[model samples]
Each structure stands twice: as structure tokens, then as C-alpha cells.
Target: MTDPGAYPNPGQHPSPHGQPPRNKRRVWPWLVIGVPVLLFGACGVAVVASVAGGNDTTVTTGPGDGDAADGGAADRGPDFPGKLDDDTAAPAGATITRDELAYTVSPLEAVDTVLGSYLCSTVTIDNVGTSQNDFNGYTDWSLQDTGGAIRDATFGPDRPMLNSGQIAPGGRATGSVCFDDRTGAAPGTYVVLFEDTFSLSTDRLAWITTL
Candidate 1:
């Protein structure tokens, strides 16, 4: 007969109700696998939330419709040409003479457009310099509203556009320089700026006026 002392008695590992202890090895493997699965699941959720949060804070520019409806009026850079500076600002109807060129701007006249109105100013440029001076209204002039939005010179319907060409000394060129103010968007004061290519001056001429 086997010695009862050599083999442990089943009563030593009995449950509270005296039943035999069940094998827990199978449950331990399942617990180990489940814990890692739960940890990975939590990590995936956190990563998705982080990605979603990043997308919510992105910034964009231009109109709500994503089109340049105002002729790119609101898309000015910090170094945009024809900005005012010291000794470069003038009032409306003033004849500013610099580098032998006399620039006179009259009060703006509102020319109606299909979408909005055009603020057209009669500009007279007198070439008093010894040499002929070249002028391009679309390329060398810009208009700025009180809100700091700048627009390039544009042509209006049934309006006389400014003539651009070489002006002989003692000669004058006069016409209308117009800016399209889409749907009265710019309804306040406006500034007419001229890039002085004659002097190559950084501080361009600015004539202040209102609508």
C-alpha cells in the first residue's frame, strides 16, 4: 500500500464547501491575454482622439466661398507695394510733387457695378522731370481701405480707365483709376497710393479720401 504521508491528501486543497480545487491555469492565460488587449484598445482610442483634436484647430484664409470674389483684396502681404510712410502721405485733392513729378488726386466718384460699386478717382500725373517717366496704373498703383485691405487698380464698366504710358517732361496724363468695392464691403475711408518709380522710393505716395 502507498504511504498516505508521501502523497498529500485532497482534503488539504479543498474549497470552502469541501469540493476539490478547480484548475486555475486556464483562467490565468485568459486574464493575461485580456489585460494586454484592453491596454492596446485604450491606446488606440487615445491616438484617434489626438488626431481628431489636431484637425479642429487648423486655420485658413480667404472668403467663406473659397473664391477670390473681391479680386484678391483681402490677400495682401506685409511687404505689399505702395504703403504709406513718413513724408509720403498726402490729403485728397492735394498735388504732391516729388522727384519732379506732380501727382494730383481728386475726390472719388462712385461708379456702379453689377456686384457692387467702383470707387473711381481722377488722377493727374504731371511729368516735370527732365526725362520721360513711365506709368502703369495697374502695375504701379493700389487702393487701400480704412480696414487696411488693399486692392489693385481695376477697370470699371462704362468708366474711363487711366491711361498708362511714357509721359514727356512738362506733359500730363489724366484719367480715372478705379477699384472694385464688392457689395459695399469697403464703405469707409480709402487711400490712393502711387509707387514712385522715378525716385525708386520705398515710401510711396498715399492720398487719403473717403467714400
Candidate 2:
């Protein structure tokens, strides 16, 4: 004794499949028949999308901003210090022979994956200052790519940064700094940027190099 109008009145609008509308069919058998089919349909769609590599899912998939065709020539390396020398202890690398301090980046290596890609190098800071020089290893360096992306040194399990400490006059400190690499359209050149102080300025030391 069911009130058809108050419940699922299939007599008014029958399901296209001729099955009772779920609300009208409030029966355990119907629930058991419906739930798994719904789950299976959802799973099937997800599987097909993944296999097709479709970006329909929540995770994003697309090119980065720097993926321009001109090889990031616009984002080329920063300017090297005017005092930098072409030949130094590391002929294949760069040396900034300035008045107060001499900074060197050498033993450069191109690292792979790294959660991505990046340029790896050891930086040496020599204090030619009149007094002891305080140095924060990573603060003294930056990496710029051809795409105009300026990156700071990354320190993690993937790459450990140099220790920050003080160097007496004529003393030197060495540490590692990494600049993240962008894939896709980019120029072959990159610039190593450095500043000896906490203040910001256009006069930071730079070394133009390639990867």
C-alpha cells in the first residue's frame, strides 16, 4: 500500500531504462544493483583519461611561462663584474678580481632531474677586505637563465649549501650553490650573480657562462 504520487510515481514519468526511479524503489535490491555500476563507470572514465594523457584531472599540466621560442635570449645572464678576469686558477671557469674581495665559481656541473634540472657549482669567496669579512655562503650568489629567470641557491637533500661564516683578511671560504634550470625553449647561456652585502644594488658581481 504505497502512495504513488507521494513517492516515485513512475506512472507519471517512467525511467528511460524502464527501471523504477531510485527514490520510488527504496529497496535494498535496487541499491545493490546501482552502487557498483556507478562506481565502475567513474573508474572507467578515470582510467581512459589517464591512458590518453588528458589533463582533465586535478593536477596541472602545461608549459611554463619561460617556454618561449626565442631560446630565452631576452632572459640572458646578468652582467659580469668589470673587474672579472678571463684567466685565473680555473681557466675554464670565471673569477671576479675586485678590490675588496675576489670571488670564484668553478668545477661547474650540469645536474639532472634534481626534482628538475639545474646548474651546480662551487663558489669561493676570498676576503681581501681590510678586516674580517662575514659571509653567508648562499646569500652571495644567484643564478639567472636566458629566460630572464633569477633563482636563488637551493639547499635540501638534493643539494647542500656552503656554510656561512667569517673569513679573516686574505682568508677564503668555499661552498656549493645551485640555480634551478627551466626546460623547453631557452638560450645556452646563464649568468652567476653575487653580492657581498645584505643591501640590494645593481652592482652585484656576475659571471657569464654556459651550461
Candidate 2 lDDT over residue span 48-131, tens digit each:
764454111110012242321111123222333232332111122445544455566764467776477667778777786688
**TM agreement with the true structure for every prediction:** 0.55, 0.49
Per-residue lDDT of 169 in model 1: 88
lDDT (Cα, tens digit) per residue for candidate 1, span 93-176? 766665556677887777786756888888888887799977776767888876777778887777767768889989998888
* lDDT of residue 139 for candidate 1: 69
- Listed per candidate, the RMSD to the true structure in angstroms reads 19.7, 19.1
lDDT of 2: 0.56
Maximum-TM-score candidate? 1
Candidate 2, superposed: residue stretches over 4 Å from native:
1-92, 113-115, 156-160, 184-187
